[model samples]
Target: MLAIECAGLTKHFGDLTAVDHVSFEVEKGERFGLLGPNGAGKTTTIRMLTTVIPPDEGTAKVLGFDVRRKPDKVREKIGVVLQGLALEFFSTVYDTLDIYGRIYKMNAENRKKRIEYLLSEFELEDKRNERIDCLSGGLQRRVQVATAFMQPPEILFLDEPTIGLDPQSRRKIWQFIEEFSKGGYTVILSTHYMDEADYLCSRIGIIDYGKISALDTPEGLKSTLGGGDIITFGVEGNVDLLRSTISKLDYVEEIMAGDELAARVENADEVLFKLSEEVVKAGAKIKNISVRKPSLEDTFIKLTGRRIE
Candidate 1:
């Protein structure tokens, strides 16, 4: 079954359009990612699908329930971990999960067992009795994540879920998410971390300026950039002049300049050699140079004309 479906889903914030005629489908148990720079409508799209907000036009269904007409039913089957930390300052880690489980109508015994399991699963056992406000930001995030899993919702919406987490904590969360996916949980992951998306998502949609710019699996998206190495040059003189020369090369697929002059070419060796000669002809001295295979970041840059940063 399709876990989520959207068709021309649009949202406007007065004078600005936050999500513009977006459409996509997510399959059951799939790890889907919404990738974009800030203000690119990634969060807005999640809100619409989660039934947190209504779309101005078009339609969305979460697990076959219309978001606008059956919001309560939709909410019942989904869990959300929003962008920032959301926790009660005075509640202990144990208390927080216990309270959430209670709200989900879990019985006392089940809540107790579930809470204990979650604390251990998320490596929060040591912080069980500690008040949330007294924990570090990472621990607070762990509590928030654990709370989301309390009811075992069919779908989980993770918005920048690992934003401030330490590397160890982040990996642990990734492992949990992977395991959850294997158990038939659908995850909609909205994150700025390209590597995280590449690591966890089965497919990704790149959004820019409120529009879906590209959609594919991580490798699929990277392949669309033509399977070339990205060559970056830090030059001492005449970057524009150097860019003009590099852009003329037949093997060069694309070029962009910011702090450095970068080009995508089919053969890095041939292009780099030609580029070196061109730079010298332009009276530019190469400060540094590097060539690497295409990555999700390169795909995003190709689509948006800039880095995600």
Candidate 2:
């Protein structure tokens, strides 16, 4: 059975449409991702699927329960970690986890054991006595996510779960999510970070302007960039001339300039040799040139005409 489904799901906020006829499905035990920038309908889609809010139009289901007609059934099987902080201000770490487990009707012995395990897993044993509000932002974020696992949910929803975490803390959470998903659990996480989506998700949906523009595995999405490779050139002089000269090449399908000049081409070897000649003719001194596989950022630019950020 599919873990979640959204067919022609739509949501509107006054004059703006937050989600527009969105459609997708996630298989059981799959780590699915919603990749998009802020206000691009990622959160709206999650909200509807989690039964936090109803879609303005269309149908959605979680674990085979229709979100609109059987919301309580859907809610009974999922865990949600929202973007904003939802932890108690004065509760200690131990109390927070214990309280959540208690609400799910977990027995005392099992709840105690789960709390102890989570305290160790989230590296929060030292903070067990500390109030939630007294912890650092990243630590508090960990506590919020930890609460979701208090009952071992069958489906987990994470919306920008690591938005404010540092690099080290971010990787820690990534490892945790990866490990947690191994026990036949389904995860649907929404994130704007390209690397985060690439590293964590088995499949990704790229959303923009209230619509899902593309959906595929990370490598699959990269392969859609005209089946080409990326070549970036670092130059010393005549940057514009180099760009113009490269742009005229027959093999160059797309050329862009930022801190450096880059192009997407069908054949890397042929394009490199030809571009080297053009650089000399254009009066530019070559600093460096590299050939690399196409990336998700490249695919996003091709589909959305801008970076996710």
**Could you give candidate 1's per-residue lDDT for residues 1-309 as a string of tens digits?**
999999999999999999999999999999999999999999999999998899999999999999999999999999999998889999999999999998899999999999999999999999999999999999899889888999988999999999989999999899989988899999999988999999999999999999999999999999987887889887888777788887887778888534578888888887688877777787888888899998898888878887887
Considering only N, C-alpha and C atoms within 3 Å, which residue pairs clash in candidate 1? none
Candidate 2 per-residue lDDT, tens place, 5-40, comes to 889999999999999999999999999999988989
For model 1 the local lDDT of residue 189 reads: 97
Clashing pairs in 2: none
Best by lDDT: 1
Candidate lDDT (C-alpha), each:
0.91, 0.90
Model 1, residue 178: what's the lDDT? 92
lDDT score of model 1? 0.91
